[model samples]
Target: MRADRLISILMMLQMEGRMTAAELARRLEVSERTIYRDMDALSISGVPVYADPGVGGGFVLPANYKMTIGGLTTAEIQAVFMHLAGGSFEQLGIGPPLRSALLKLLHALPDQSRRDAEWIQQRIYLDPESWSQDEKTAPYLQAAQQAIWEQHAVTMTYTSREGHELCLKLKPYGLVAKAGVWFLVGETEGNVRAFRLLRIDSLEGKQEERFVRPEDFDLQVFWQEWLEKYESR
Candidate 1:
């Protein structure tokens, strides 16, 4: 447990540049004194960790220092690469970038870990589409993703299940991809609703208006509750 905590501390400092002992303790769920001891251990072990005392002072590494993936075990490498094989990035329009990142991670691994990851990738297949069904991304998916990311309200020309065409102003809270289909979860006229991406005939002026996301909203929890309610019916 201490070993993992030490690695996490090193990673936090490396990524954040500088952090106070109190901040590290709060993030790591430990006491401030423990953070001081851990910092000492890192410095003594040739990690080049340093601390500055006083207000606005904290722990930092030299800007030129770089951390490597040498600490990862074989199982850890396999787990990471296996997740990459699951194939959700393609629907998000980032398949090429995801492949590039996988190659970089493979190159960074040790020889045996690289081999294990490759072997796992070959054996584990994630086919999200159903057999005999032609699955394709929704036409307005990219637009909805952009609107959700930028916190913009979109005017959508949508086709309802009963074949009615309606215009809606949507404050997009999040986008969910399930089993190769995408849904936009958001609010329409003060009522929370989910819009199937495929039902949108067109989207207009995604960035023309912006809205703040509610602080109390959580996508995963909301989805789970929705699933429970749907299943109970």
Candidate 2:
């Protein structure tokens, strides 16, 4: 548990740049003394974590310093690959990278950890498709994903449920995969709408400065509410 706690502190300082001991202790639910001790442990372990002094001072990692994930236990190694093997990575375009990463980790892991991982791999499997339905194809799904990552708008051509060809410029927010279908959630004409990715005939990302995402938008909350209204109809 202390290993996980120390890693958490390391990650927090790495991402947040500077955090007061009080803040770290509060978030980590430990005492300030414990946070300081953990900081020392991290420093001794060769993690470049250091503390600032006086007003607005805390702990920070160097801006350019980063460490790759290593020292994985059997359970950790298993957990990392379970979801990648569960059948969505290909459509999301991350399958190859995940496979390469798994191979790298497997090659470096202890023999027992590798054996445990291989045993689980041979035993447990996952497929997300439904037996009764055909898998839907979304040729533009990757482009939509790109637009979301780029924080840009896209001009998209799609057929509506009523079967009309229409075009709209959408501020792409996120993509959701349900069963075997993908949905593009975006803001268009001052309203957020979910467009079935299969129906989108084309998508062209805007080549402009990054669009500002709304401050209050929460994708998880929005998706859950969307599902409620969608399934009710």
Candidate 3:
């Protein structure tokens, strides 16, 4: 955590040009003495850090001293890389791009920080079932994400547990993940419904019937409304 703070302080100086010790102390939630010690630690560790001892100067890293994702203080990179690898951010399809970005950022980090990043990568992981095994709604989930972004309409063949197959055409509002299941919540026949993705049989989208969503549409409110509908309370 101290290392992370050190990196953040350097980054702030790099971004903000300069800051006073009091300001840094407030931002860091530490004392001025602690800030001084941290500055000393950073300088001793080969970070091009310095403080101007005057009425105007506090602490600053070189203007060119930016925190490259490559130069991250290990834990930062691991947190991001793990999120990408874990399929949590799979919706973006930028997983490989993120990995490459992390590598580029790694190049800017100190040698010790780089080693820490590698160690963190090796230690932490997120292993969820592949989207393909979802059987029922994988395709629909993908479609819903697309529709949410593109403002398109989607049609799906949905089956209830009673084995009734119904064709639904709706304006896709949002895609939500709840309790390991994917739900596509949208307006169907003038009412909102949360359709289980896996239970959706055949899905397709048409580009012609697009409509503008209300500017006030709030996901949290929609979710609460959905819950109310579910309980019939």
Residue 107, candidate 3: C-alpha displacement in angstroms: 3.6
What is the Cα-based TM-score of model 3?
Answer: 0.55
TM-score of 2: 0.71
Estimated TM-score per prediction? 0.73, 0.71, 0.55
RMSD of 2: 4.4
Clash count for candidate 2 is 0
lDDT: worst 10-residue window of model 2: 128-137
lDDT of 2 by residue, 2-68 (tens): 9889878878887888999988998899999999899889899898888789898988899999866
Off by over 4 Å in 1: 12-62, 132-134, 157-166, 214-218
Go through the candidates in order and give the clash count of each: 0, 0, 11
Q: Candidate 1 — what's its lDDT?
A: 0.83
**Of 2 and 3, the candidate ranking higher by TM-score:** 2
Per-candidate Cα RMSD to the true structure, in Å, reads: 4.1, 4.4, 9.0
Candidate lDDT scores, in order, read 0.83, 0.84, 0.75
